[model samples]
Target: MSTDDADHPLTRAELRARRAAEEAAAGVEAAAPEDSEPAEPSEAAAPRASTAADAPEAPQVPAVPTADEPVTRSAAPEQVFDDTPGPRRTPNAGSGTSASTADAAPAQAEAEFPDVAPAPAAAAATRVHQEDPPLVPDDAHVEEPPADPQLAPPTDPRLEPPEWQPHPTPAPVARRRRFPLVLGAVIGALVLVVAAFGVITLLQGPRVSSVKIDAQSAIDASGTRMIITASQPLAKVDPKQVSVSPKAPFTVDTSGRNLGIRFTVPLDDDTTYTVTVKDATGTDKQRQSTLQATFQTPKSTIFLLQRNADGDDTIFLTDLGGKNAVPVVQHEKIDDFRATADHLVVATEKGGTSVLLVMDRKGKNQRELKLPGPGFLSNLQVSERGNLVGYTFTDKGISATSGRASILVSQSLTGDGEPQIVTVGDKMPSIAQWAFVPDSSSALFIDFSGALYVEDRSDAKAKPTALGAAQTVEGISRGTYTAIVSRGNDLVELNLADGSEKPLAASTPDFGVPGTIAPFPGGTLRQVATRDATGLPTGQIVTRVDDDGKATKLFSVTGSDAIMQACPSPSGQYSAIVVAPKLVNNPYDQSLLPLPTTMQTHIVDTKTGKELVVLAGFDPSWCAQAPHR
Candidate 1:
């Protein structure tokens, strides 16, 4: 090689031509034997002008080492060849070949001399020459070489790796990105936990979630319902499993998740009652728990009537303390009055006839009720459950066969319809005394013929049930379906439901046979006459007789003060004793059901016989009807 060629390196075209010629000669020598003549060069082996499309095809070659495998070669003076394609070399001005034709030379040489081994030194020298400066000037514009079809296509721009940077994300930005994920995880966990707890609670026994009780209703009347709502639906509850503190009679009914406890009788006023149901369970019966509720009843108040012959008679509503007495109703002459849960029924005499006035508890809205005819009303009584008021009526002008005399009649408190005449065998018989059965529309009446009959006023088709002969129906026990009646010489308890008769037992500690018996829940209130050794009436004693024949002395009137009537409070907690102070001096009023003008009502506790209060009134609202003389 010349010095200029050695310094500047021969152009790639000249190098490739020289390498191809040497490989073609070596191939021809290897194909000929020692005794054979040298083979002539073929057109394919000789160097010629070629384009990329007209380049000679590559010969079949033996396996070569891959890019990753280590290659070894001998240190021989001969030229080295590589099977790997290299970068295309630009042709010099003296060479008549293009860059494409120069690129095809190496492939052609490798095909002709398939046994040629690669040299490390030559490969290093070729790489060094490739990195050197181009033979062309910097000012000249050179064309980019065309892509070789044998090589893989360039990688897609979209698939290229993104630009790298050393910037770390800001702390706040990283936290903001992760906040939603963390919150979602926590909220999901909380929801799952709450759902699990709710399922567990439902699988267990019923627990009382809430309770509702009408305190006013509980203290004022019987059959008041207290509802206990549970967390889940409950199983049936039996009455035997229920117990009430302070010992009030009650019936149990369970529906769905609500447990209803209906007090069969009124509860004591201003008292706290605890009701417990034992072995309460859920509908599945998987577990058992006790369901209990506590409620406080409100204080009770009562109404009393004061008849004044000189002025307007007044009906006063007062608490047991007798300090706060409010006049509720006033009329010229009030013969009898009865009070219900929300209303008052007052019987007043106008001219010579009776007028019935129904008013609210405050006596603001007064309305006249329709009567059977122009008659005198007596024995006014009210049934709170049936919303009815009953009375005995007698026509003002009454002859032997012309007018209605002491006939029993009942009507609605709203005065919507005419009074219904009570009948036996299609005839309106004269009733001597009648009383409403507690909590029902049925009436227990003693006709003038001395026959006791129970008739259901709610059903017009139902006939009266005759209960044989009875002197008088003293009183009926609430919820017991039993009535205390005076039969001949003995007092008997008549079962109004089944017509069964049993002698009324005398009070223990023997108060002697009572003159008047007033039946209430839990017991009866009796006004017994105290007699001297001479067998003469000396004084009056009001006694409480319990269900088990236990007797307690509640009140007494001695000397001149006389106890006209003894009545029990709704729950038997208190007794109202109507007394006339200075009996000889107290004159009788001119009303139909007249009492002494100077009458006083004494409120006494039945259990302890302690007198609560005394007020100037008679015929307390606690009594079902006016006292019969």
Candidate 2:
């Protein structure tokens, strides 16, 4: 785990010195000098005599003393003649040298060299040199020398050259510390190898926790039993320390090897959730992620207002419930009309030509819901499934082609033609502005004036027939198909069996009315959440009717600004809006003057009309990211 410590500063000189020292100490060994020749004993005799003369008398070396110490010589013999190195002619040995030097030199030369005695010296000087007898028999000679306490007789002449030789370097002193050095080097190498392997292993490992889901690939409602899988052990995470948000009320199942959780919600709706894992110390590797069948709940009032900018009718998709104003589409020439969803779709002019563009709910392009030849579709209707599309347009030579539209009924595998007329109807509906019921026998249509119509296309081979105006529209929910409808502020409901209308409630000035209706799968189209006469949200309350047909407020908007366009969060608990000022100097000016300074996106807890988050300059589109596996 340790490298060079980087916490402290090291100067360049210090670093270099440290590196050099490390290198020098890495590989240490004993070194020897080149020469290995042995010297003749006489070579030491001269130095011995000279050293005795020059060196002061040394105190007698201490010895293991007996009761009576043995007599020790004050002056010792210097050397034997064999220990002598260079030519030593003794002519001046007696004359030039002192008498004591003469005496000690001869004795030392004889004792140390062991070859300067008269007989041997005389024979060696007079006779020709010859080899000595072999010490061992040729046939019985041993491979190795016999062990003896004493050293070998001088060195054998057989091993020595018959010439003067330089002094042999003494055998290098055996370094006893060598073993530790070798051991240390080996350990260092091993440590580096292991460290490198560990680093490589760690670098290649994944940093994010893997999450897997068991059982159903999709969740249909809350309280669905499910499992969230993890790659590591679950014990590392403490449930008490962990936090799962969106707080949609759910029970976590931490008993298994992998972390699994169960969900419970008041309303049965699809939701996506996040589960955060923390240790007992409230710390975690990072935040763990998972998703389930959950959606955003729009429990507040939001709006969008079409603004005029750059001589164009700019349509903004927003949550005007607060200080948010997001211009969905802006153009100087094109008429900016809006379509609703997590993603936006619009019909605008590009290069003086009318083109159908299906932008993201935020007015960003996905695929252009394009069509050929258009004066620009005046009315465009998209089905809840986003499959059925209907629009009205005027082509060349067509004078106010009032209600020319096409529906997807014919193209779908399951659809009966719901229309035969190619023109607008005075009262009965015209063109292809209706969606045939699932049975393909009857159809439902929303007129330009926001009136609901039931059409009978059972006799599709013949002319289609109108089922007449719906008897009661009071609280007639698009989500529940059970809401009361109002006729000039007179609210009523219809008895399905008899088709008879009954008034539910009389008009009340305090209760705001509905404008247009949009359909939801199994929920109610609660209310008309918008601005009132004061340019502030007064009718900014959600009105929902229960099974008892009693309508009441589900949530309220407490914002001051009038709501323009309201887009519900996917879960329907939050709303995003675009706000507009009450007055406009020029509705169609090429340059918008003095626009709202803060054009940010606002998010609020729809249940309380309490603001949650505000993101500046960023308009969020409902782009869903689901678990891949």
TM-scores, all models, native as reference: 0.70, 0.37
Residue 332 of model 1 has an lDDT of 88
Please give the distance, in angstroms, between residue 16's alpha carbon in candidate 1 and its true position after superposition: 54
Candidate 1 lDDT, 1-629, residue by residue in tens: 22132234443323333333333333321111112122222222224222222224333332121111111111122222333355433223332211222223234334544445333333332232222211222222233233554431122223221221113447788899999999999999999999997988876678889999889988777889999999889899999989999898888899999999999898999999999989999888888999889999989899988887778999988999988999888888889988888898889888888999998999988999988888898888988988999988999889987999999998889888778998888799999888889988899899999998898887768788888998877889987889999889989988888888888886789988788889888788888889999999888998888889999888887888888888888888888888889989988888878778888888888889988888988899988877665
TM-score for candidate 2, please give it. Answer: 0.37
Error of 2 at 287 (Å): 31
lDDT of 2 by residue, 1-629 (tens): 11123344432222222222222233321121122122121211223111112222222222211111111111222221222344322222111111111123233334544533433322331111111110111122122221221212122223222222333333343344576788899999999999997675344331223454422212222334445544333444444654555554455665434455554422212344555554321023333333223233222222233334424545554443444555656655333333333434445566555665555555555455535354445434333332344445544334464533332222111222332332225333333244433212344554544455554433334433333344333223222233344455555554322346666542233345554332222223244656767776554555443334345454444544433333344334454443333323213233112234234445654445666665442223321110010
- Which 10 consecutive residues of model 1 have the lowest summed lDDT? 66-75
Q: Could you tell me the lDDT of residue 545 within candidate 1?
A: 89
Clashing pairs in 1: none
- Poorly placed runs, candidate 1 (over 4 Å): 1-190
